[model samples]
Target: MRDSLRFYLGDELREIRDVDPTLTVLDWLRLSERRLGTKEGCAEGDCGACTVVVGRLTEDSQGGKSVRYEAVNACIRFLATLDGCQLLTVEHLKGPDGALHPVQRALVEHHGSQCGFCTPGFVMSLFALYLNEDRPDERRIDDALAGNLCRCTGYAPIVQAARAMHDLGDRTADRFNDRAATAARLKALADEEILSVGSGDRRFLAPATSAQLAELLLGHPDATIVAGSTDVGLWVTKFQRVLSIVLYTGRVTELRRVADTGDALEIGAGATYSEAAPAIAALYPDFGELIRRIGAEQVRNMGTIGGNIANGSPIGDTPPALIAAGAALRLRRGDATRTLPLEEFFLAYGKQDRRPDEFVEAVILPKPAPGARFRAYKIAKRFDQDISAVCGAFRLSLDESGNVAGIRIAFGGMAGVPKRAAGAEAALIGQPWSEASVHAAMAALKADFTPLSDWRASAGYRAEVAANLLLRFHVETTDPATETRLVGDRRLAHA
Candidate 1:
C-alpha cells in the first residue's frame, strides 16, 4: 500500500503524499498551482470553462498500449482520479520561447475570442480534438465544442478556428506526439499497490484490481465509488457536500474494458460513453446516436454507462435504451457475483437493488434477436448539454405474418425508475404492425406512467411526447424513406 498519489503534471512528475479526496482539480489548479488559466464557469460539468486535457495509456485489442488524450471538465473531476495519468493545463500549451500552440494560434487568427473568459477552455478542447483527429468535419467540430458555451456570442469565429487549426501546422510535429516516452512515464507510475490518502474527515482508497476493490468495498460499504465524477463532482462543487470515504474505481483496470462475446456484449462498469460508442453503433445505430446526445464531448468522455445505471437516476438517458435492449446487470460482493435484469435493478427513485457491499461489475447486453428493430429518443429543451425530460426506447420484432411477435418498451423520466412499459408491450404483442396497434400501445403508456410536472417539462407534455415518440418510431420503421428527425439536413435551413 502507498499513501500517496503519483501522476505527470505536464512533463513534471508529481508524487504527493498529502491529498484531499474530495478536492476538485479546478480548485487545486487555481489555489495550489496558481494556474488560473482554467476558469470555472458553472462549477459543474455543464459549462466547459474548466475543460482540460488528460492523457493516459490505453491498451488495444491486440494488447498494444498507447497514449490516448481526451478533454474533460476539471471543475467536477477530483484530484485523486488523476493517479497514473498526465494532467495538462492551458498554461502548459506554449513553447519555452512563448510560442502559442496551434490551437491557440488558430483561435487568435480567426478572432475566436470576444470576452476571452472561455477561450482557454476552447483551446484545451480543440487541443484534444487536434491530437485525436487528423481531419474533423463540420459536424464533428460542432460535436467536439458542444460542451463549451460562449457567452460573448462569438461562436462563428470559434468554429472557423476549429476548421482552420489543422492548416496551421502538422499535428505530428507537436511535442505531445512523443507517445512512447509518455507511455513509459505513465507505466512507471502503474502498480498493484493500493493508494490510501486524504485529509482529516475525507479518505480516498484506489485499488488497481477488481478483487481488491471488492475487498475494500466489502470492508467499507458506504464508501463513495467514483469512476468519472460527472455526477459525484457536482455534490462537492454545487451542494458543498463533503465525502467521507471515497473509493476511486477509475484506476481499476478490469472495470474499464468493453468486450464483445459471441452472444452478448460485456461493458465494464468504468467504460466511458466514448469508449463504448463504436461497438454500440455497429449493433444499434439509433441507440448509438442517442449516446452522442447524452452530453457534450467532455461529459461523454468521462461519464460511464455503468455509473449512469448505478446512480439510479430516472432521468438518465441511457437506461431506457439499455433496458429496451434486454440488458442485465452484474454485481459483485467480495468473491461472489450475481446477475439480474437491468430493469429490476432499479427499485425506486434514489433507490436501487444494489446491496451495500456489492459493486456494479458490468452490464451484459444480449444481441438483439434477428429482425429486431430498435429506436431511442431523447426529448430535451436544448439539443446539447441538457437533461432529458422524457426518454423512450422501443424494440419490436414482427413475425412472418406481419404481426408483432416480441416487443419491449422502456422509458425514463416517466416514473420513479427506468421501467419497462409492460402495459404498452402487452397492447402491441401479437397484434398487426399497423397504426391501430401503435395507437393502442401509445394509449397504454398513460396507464404505465404518471410523470410529475417539473421545470424541464409538464406531466401532460411528458405523456404526449412519450406517445408521439412511439408513433414516430413506428412511422420511421414502417416507411424507411420518411424523414422524422429534423437534425439532419434541416439544421442548416434554420440558419
Candidate 2:
C-alpha cells in the first residue's frame, strides 16, 4: 500500500502526505501552494468560481496513453482525489514566453471579465472546451458556462469569447496540447496499491481496483464512499461535518467504464454524467435532455448516476427517469453481488435499501422494447444549474389494437422517495390512447402522491405540473399535426 498521494500540478509532480482527509483541493491550492487564482465563491459545488481542470489517463485506439481533461468544481473536490491525475489551474495556462493561452487571450480580447472574480473559473471552463472541441456552437458554449455566474458582466461578452476561440485556428501545436508525456507520468504513478493517507481515525483510502474497493468496504463499512464529491463535499463545506474515513471510488478504474452488452447498457457506478450521456441518449433521448439540464457542464462532468442513486435524494434528476425506464442496480459487498430494481433501492426520505459494507457497482438498463415510448420532464425555476421542483418520467407501450399495453410512470419530489405512480399506471393500462384515459391517469396521480410544499414548489403546483406533463406527452405522441414542444414549434415554423 502506498502511504502517500502523488499527482501532477502543471507538469510538476508533487507528493502529499499527512493531510486532512476532508481537505478540499481549493483550500490546498490557496493555502498550501499559494496559487490564489482559483477563488471560492460558494464552498458548495454550485458556484464555478473555483473551477479547475482535472486530467486522467485514458487509452487511445492504438493502445497509446492520452489524457482526458474535465472541468470540475475544485472547492468541493477533495485533494486526495487528485492522486495519479493532472491538475490544471488558471495560472498554468500561460506559455513559456509568458504569452496568454488562447482562451485567456480570447477573454481579454472580447472583454469577458469585469471585477475579475469569476474570470479564472470561466477561463478554465473555456480551456477544457478548447482542448476537447475545435469549434463549439452557441448551445455548447451556453452549457459550458452554465455553472458560472457573472454578476457584473452579462454572459454576452463571455459567450463572445467562447466563439472567438474557434477563430484562433489549429491549437494542436499549443504548449499544453501534448498529453503523451503527462500520460506516461500518470501511468507510472498508477498502481494496485491502496493509497492510505492521513492520521489516526481521520483518513482517506483510494483503492485502485473494484476488488480492492469491495474488500476495503467489507473491512470498513462505515467509511464514506466518495465518487465525485459533488454531494459529499457539501457535508464538509455547508454542514461543517468532518468525515473520518473516506473511501474514494474515483481511482477504481473499473467503476469508471461504460459498456454495452447487447441485452443491456452497463454504466459503472463511478461513471460521470459526461461519460454516460451518449449511451443514455442512445437508450432514451428525453433522458439525454434531462441529463443535460442536471447541473450544467461542471456538475455533469463530476456527478455520477450511481452517486445520485446511492445518495437517494427524492429530487435527484436522474432517479425518476431511471426508475421509469426500468433500470436496475448492481450492489457489491465483499465478493457477493446483488441486483435490485432502482425504485426499490430508495426506502424513504433520506434512507436507502443499501446495506452496510455494500456499495453500488453498476446500473444496468435493459434495452427498450420495440413499441416503447419514453419521455422525461424536469420542471424547475431556471433552465440551467437548478434543482428540480418536480421530475416526471413516463414509459408507455401500445398494443396492436392501439390500447395501452404496458405503462410505467414514476416521479421525484412528489413524495419521500423517487417512486412509481402505481395508481396512475393502473389507470392507463389496457386503456385506449385518448384524452379520457389521460384524464383518468392524471386524476389517479393525486391518489399516488401527496406532495409536500417547499420553496421550489408547492404541493398544488407539483400536482398540476405532473398532470400537465402527462397531457403534453400524450399530445406529442398521439397527435401527428400537434406540436406541444417549443423546439418542435420552432422547427414547424422554419419548415
* Model number with the top lDDT: 1
- Candidate 2 yields a Cα-based lDDT of 0.89
Question: Model 2: residues >4 Å from true position, as ranges?
Answer: 59-64, 481-484, 487-495
Window of ten residues with lowest summed lDDT in model 2: 486-495
lDDT by residue (1-495, candidate 1, tens digit) is: 999899999999998888989888999999999999999999989889999999998887788778889999999999988999999999999999999998999999999998999989999999999988998998899999999999885789999999999998789888987888999999988999999998776789999999999999999999999989999999999899988999989888789898999999999999999998888878877778889898899999899989999999999998999999999999999999999999999998999998998999999988888888888888898877789999999888999999999999999999999999899899999999999999998989889999999899999999999999889888977885553445433331100
- Candidate 2 lDDT, tens digit per residue, 1-495? 999989999989999898899899999999999999999999888779999999998656565668999999999989999999999999998878998888988888999998999999999999999988888888788889889988998899999999998676456766677877778789999889999999999999999999999999988989999998999999999999989999999888789888899989999999999989988888888888889888868889889989999999999999999988899999998899999999999998998888889999999988889868888888888878899999999888999999999989999999999999999899999999899999999999899999999999999999999999889889878875743355321221101
Computed on alpha carbons, the lDDT of every model, listed in order, comes to 0.90, 0.89
TM-score of 2: 0.97
